[model samples]
Target: MAESADASGGGENKSVHVCVAFNVSNSKMPAFCEAACKLLAHAKADKGCRRFDFQREVNWLRSVSNEEHSLFMVRQGWDTADAVEAHVKSPHAQRFDGTLVSESMLVCAPSLSLFGSAMTTSDLAAIAAEARATQGSEAAEPAGTSSRPVSAARSNGSRPSS
Candidate 1:
């Protein structure tokens, strides 16, 4: 999974949060982990990377119930979307393709997702307040109006002072 600022409009800064999962059979776990470690080392060395970490599920019962194969999760944070794009095209990332497909490894193709959202604090407080107010209510707020303060600042073309 990757989340970043929207690229559609002007003055929008782009950043990314990415997580990828790889499934490997128990027998191939060691090899897969070694390859992942090598990849992580290179990724961490990249200037645009803010974070790069890997984790293996340790609960056998949960793994058996959800997936028979071992699961490894790679989490990463990039300073910008361009950084992520560059990393994907880097030679180190390219090498992983061969390692993942090697005869001794049972790693499956990784699952990935990317999301983009506008980065702004606008209306957050109002939304949070409304959520708190409606914690146990079943009714939804009306279309044009909000739960009190929602539109107060936006209507004035200014953000509420933090």
Candidate 2:
């Protein structure tokens, strides 16, 4: 991936890091995950998207194991604010506006924040590099219980190591 900031100047307000938390109702788990996966897949291809990933919280107890909630981090390199607005308006996002949620479902806007020096392209790369370096050989392990090793090149290029 190319590391270039869309910022016109060295101004501090160039880009933003958006972390959205979804408090999904327990009953809405499947639909939310499906729609979320579709949105992330599309957003990953968006021009303004520097990096994007979704994280699900671990449920220690079986009682809360089914609790549905997640965090989506979309790092908008230079056009953070505008990109977020456009994301909400984009077809990939609008599709889930109403259809993804049932009457009992609830939703909330992501708490937006700016990451001055931290929002730069270099910062993102360093973070990714650190993760990849930590994972090392473990990242090559087979998916699930299969002993088959994942393709070395494919795993390296897929995304920053978990």
Candidate 3:
């Protein structure tokens, strides 16, 4: 992992950082955490990978993120734009991404934000398009309640917890 540099740093900054949040059910929290451990191992192996943090939020009832159920946030940083892109395309990322981007593990697509000098607005748009493609397009549903099957939001009387 390289040193994280910003405007304060002496050289050009081409770093990128991504923050993603997932709303998971208590039933799947343990499994998700276990998967994250493996993901971290992959991150550690990438020299471009700098920061990786996974945090559980207990006070979601008061959270501004609007994530109801249980929530976990992952923040990762890379030294270069190419590094960020490559990390995501890596097999390890795909292994968990299939589950993370699916309703079986998350109530919905995780809230995501990308920031850095190396990434551009077009890059953000492309990333969003890719996410939509992964989730598959959804037809318009009536207002009120969602007909979509949200596995993590199932009302089995089990409260969502990390």
Candidate 4:
């Protein structure tokens, strides 16, 4: 499993959905599926686990670089990033990785993406402001730029000449 983002902040609970895609050796897919079952079962019992599922790619044979291999996806949702991190570090998940992922069974490291995280505009603005301060002169906008509405200069929808 890939690392979970540090999404905890502002005393607000933010749910996260994690998706991991795997392409594995076709001959080893059965073994991968069997191990994932135990991992999912253990993770489902974890605190703040909202959903967990492991699915096979029915169209895998058409897309896989080698017809002998297959694809799969793991979709999970949790009440917090902490839950996802804990699940990743859990012994069952570790065992699953040890059993299949650490070896040559997988075509590549699993691809992971996390969604549904919420952040305040103010929090984002603060980060932008800090970056601007540290960036010094490079942060300045080009002289031709203006803060005015574009229509003020080009109401006829004609392109400005260079």
Candidate 5:
């Protein structure tokens, strides 16, 4: 599944999302790619993992072929930060490190947006409500909670902007 983001304001049961960029070495490209794909599958199967996948940058140069280094982007999501950390320490990850990290750099950081689910007006309103509810006010309800307002688009057939 595609990676989903955390829109909940309560910060309870927050999904931990990470985007990692990798630079692989020359001779290790094939092996590294194989290991990475395996690790991604393994991560996705782990508990609390919503998504785990890798993407390679497409090259525009058709004739010259400038393949100095390949870039890979990995997206992973978990129910909590600790769960994500545990996923990183999994056996598949350890195998990945042994196979791909000999001469490569891995840069990981949080993501503002993720791959799953499109944005909608109702989604925004629900998030706002959740913020208000958590802040101890009647202004709005919580997003994921049952107290939040349901999406009108679902019943009225309203389409959100792209």
Candidate 6:
């Protein structure tokens, strides 16, 4: 999964995080990646964008029938929720949406989520607690049996053993 975090200090400043995952058929993977790269470039150039990243999931068990297509993740951070809204309304985003709707692209519907800080202190505390609990569970798992899935590639061009 692609992950990005943006933090801004000041009582008036708030950060927004957006994450999206897409599945593209093997035949259309190349075109999808090319288009996605262009879209990301445009987003990164936007004044509102603070951070942007893309990642392709590597399926070690490709011989199995679990997945027929490749998964791509897009992670982004914006200065505020309004910035994210403006990005969605941008021309580049409109064109990218059109690409997603094209039949020849062979891309499945994407899963998307947007996150922003909670208004109340109690709500923020609850969210933080839940995140910590999730992390603890993953740390408790045996090596190779982690609840959190790991990407296939390492920075050094090596794959972790399954």
Best candidate according to lDDT:
4
In candidate 2 the C-alpha lDDT for residue 14 amounts to 56
For 17-59, candidate 5 gives per-residue lDDT tens digits of: 6666565444567777777778877888888888787876566
Ranking by TM-score: 4, 6, 1, 3, 5, 2
Among all windows of 10 consecutive residues in model 6, the one with the lowest summed lDDT is 1-10
Candidate 4: C-alpha lDDT: 0.70
Alpha-carbon deviation at 22 in model 4, angstroms: 0.8
In order, the Cα lDDT scores of the candidates are 0.63, 0.55, 0.68, 0.70, 0.58, 0.68
Residue 122, candidate 3: C-alpha displacement in angstroms:
25
Model 2: how large is the Cα RMSD against the reference? 15.3
**Model 1, runs deviating above 4 Å:** 1-13, 60-68, 104-107, 116-162
Q: In terms of TM-score, which candidate is stronger, 2 or 4?
A: 4
Clashing pairs in 3: none
RMSD of each: 12.3, 15.3, 12.5, 12.3, 12.2, 10.8
Compose the digit string of candidate 4's lDDT tens values, residues 1-162. Answer: 223343433224478888887777787877877788888889899888999998776654344435666667788988877888898888988898898856567866667778765567876787788767755554475755645334455342211112
Model 1 lDDT tens row, 1-162: 223334321234465767776666667667777777788889999878988898776776435213446666678877777788888888888787577876445434566644343334554565566678785352465565545445343341111122
Q: Can you rank all candidates by lDDT, best first?
A: 4, 6, 3, 1, 5, 2
Reference-based TM-score of each model? 0.60, 0.49, 0.59, 0.62, 0.52, 0.60
Query: Candidate 1 deviates by what RMSD?
Result: 12.3
Identify the candidate with maximal TM-score: 4
How many clashing pairs does model 5 include? 2
Q: Which prediction has more favorable lDDT, 1 or 4?
A: 4
User: Which residue ranges in model 4 land beyond 4 Å of their true spot?
Assistant: 1-13, 60-66, 117-162
Alpha carbon deviation, residue 151, candidate 2 (Å) = 52
